[model samples]
Target: MTDIPLEHVHVAPDDGADSEPAPAVFVLHGRGADEEDLLPVAAELPDELHVVSLRAPDPLQGGYTWYELDLSAGGLESSQPDAEDFRRSLDLIVESVDAAVDAYGLDADRIGLLGFSQGAITSLSLLLEEPDRYAWVVALHGYLAASYASLDPDGIESKPVFVGAGAGDRVIPESRTTAAVDRLEDVGADVASGSFPGGHGIGPQELEAVVEFVAARAV
Candidate 1:
């Protein structure tokens, strides 16, 4: 993955305000989806915001995946993200955020994150590592990875986070989803969670809630 360069798609406000940096949102797609997969969602954000979607480094099943899922022991076990690769990607993203703030003239303190599935997992991991970095986060159809258990909510500043799951999702079981939300809330994160009626995907209702969540962060 190191040999391959990181790729991304950037969408600036269409209101002819290209020269000034504005608020920003980082969009992350699910496993097997490319950077552009979430552009439509990005477009739904405030027009004064700059949006950027990033592609995962590793390739899988002809698409891209953030890491290798280790489901060997009957049920889902863990992920096999190359430690070095994961570290490098993390560093690059932190740098990217800083670069976006400068290059796009974004409000440095108002950056937010939106992600689905594996993308959501990555976003949450990043936030746990640096709680003060993002103003808010919207995670869809995903849970907090077990590896992040070492993160304590008491050690970090409070921040808003939205986690939406599918009530019928077997992929990420309800127990795991509930546990994730509980853990985040226990750690002092202002967590807002809900369940859509469907399964492992976001529907129109979830999108509406996500937009409202992000909008409220602007207040």
Candidate 2:
């Protein structure tokens, strides 16, 4: 197990409006990507809200990866051996979110998580595993990992979730995306979903949907 530390860079509101006790959106990036890749997305979001983009723990060959992958194995390499270490990274992220909330005097009940691809997987997994931790979750171009099937949805029913996928996403099959949405709905999450005609990435329409979802729920 390797210890991975979560690193973050904050993007303050452009409005220069006095920072209110507003909820934050923690942005996570995809595989081989860095924290800066998704930080710009915050600009399109409501300026009244806070945005924090984080870097994954481990540095890969060209960039970074949240967990190791064995292409030969067909799926994620067993993170079991490194579960404790991996979880520690997640703990750091959670702590960071709490710190941001406290620092800004934001309403804890309004905090949310937003991630793309691998980051999306992490966001969804964390929310499912700790149902009461976040008020809302936005997963873009990411599928639900199988480990989430064991989660108890007692506290998650009222939590809002926005899931978006590319219709032409060859990496994540449409069936898998539909299944993920079904599972979340079944578990009581207020789920809203959409699919765009593109590859494994977010398009203009997808971004608009995300903005709407967050604006309606986070504020």
lDDT of 1 at 77: 24
Residue by residue across 47-155, what tens digits does model 1's lDDT show?
7777878788778777787776655535652333445655666777777777667666678778888888887877888899988788888888777776685688443
Clashing pairs in 1: 21-104, 21-105
Model 1 error, position 59 (Å)? 1.9
Off by over 4 Å in 2: 1-5, 15-19, 70-86
Q: Which whole-number lDDT from 0 to 100 does residue 43 have in model 2?
A: 69
Specify the highest-TM-score model's number: 1
The lDDT values for all models are: 0.76, 0.76
Model 2 TM-score, 2 decimals: 0.86
Prediction RMSDs, each to the true structure: 3.2, 3.9
lDDT of 2 by residue, 14-89 (tens): 6557656666788888878888888667668887777878888788767776765434435542212135544665
**Model 1's lDDT to the true fold?**
0.76
